[model samples]
Target: MTTFDDREKAFENMFAHDQEMQFRIQARRNRLLGEWAAAKMGLTPEETDAYAKAVVQADFEEAGDEDVIRKLMGDMTQAGIDIDEAGVRAALDEQQVIARRMFIEAQ
Candidate 1:
């Protein structure tokens, strides 16, 4: 391949890698967020694990974090926990940071 073609391929590969990493980071964040919400709801250890998985699955329902947030909020409400969107958003941001840090450390 010509140098230009080689460079283009490298950039495409880099973009793909970045997208995969972002997906992983978001998934980790979702799991962490699920764990946090589970604790707030006083879920049992076994239930917590399942709930965390459910939260991660919720993300597949839509394109962005809203689906996961909605699931958490609805579940929390049913559990008689008082929390708002802002609280959930804050937790999401916090967990994302933790997720990114964990990924970096792993590398």
Candidate 2:
């Protein structure tokens, strides 16, 4: 006894729930990245705060996820931080896996 309207409503509810889950997962990833970056920088408390802000700002301003990771890797290298491409790629891959999981869950 399902009508067209009922089906549409169900789809809309599912879509909204998926979107929420994706956002939550992304937020978690960002927080983790900020902590990792701060530790890598070996910053003092004050410097860590500034570094975390810069990380989040860069995340916002980057063109996309890949671009954000590339920028971070490049900056780290330029800073003489001794980070390799493999490490950067691995971090990005981990985050991508989380994102993909969220996408699948949404579906």
Q: Pick the candidate with the highest TM-score.
A: 1
- lDDT (Cα, tens digit) per residue for candidate 1, span 29-81: 99999999999999999999999999999999989989999999999999999
Please provide, for model 2 over 2-106, each residue's C-alpha lDDT reduced to its tens digit, 9 standing for 90 to 100: 698899999999999988876666655654565566677676878767665665566666455665576668767776788877887677668657756766777
* Worst ten in a row by lDDT for model 2: 26-35
What is the Å distance of residue 5 in model 2 from its true position? 1.1
Q: Which candidate wins on lDDT?
A: 1
Distance (Å) between predicted and true CA of 71, model 1? 0.5
| lDDT by candidate, in order shown | 0.96, 0.68
Show model 1 residue runs off by greater than 4 Å. Answer: none
Clash total of candidate 2: 0
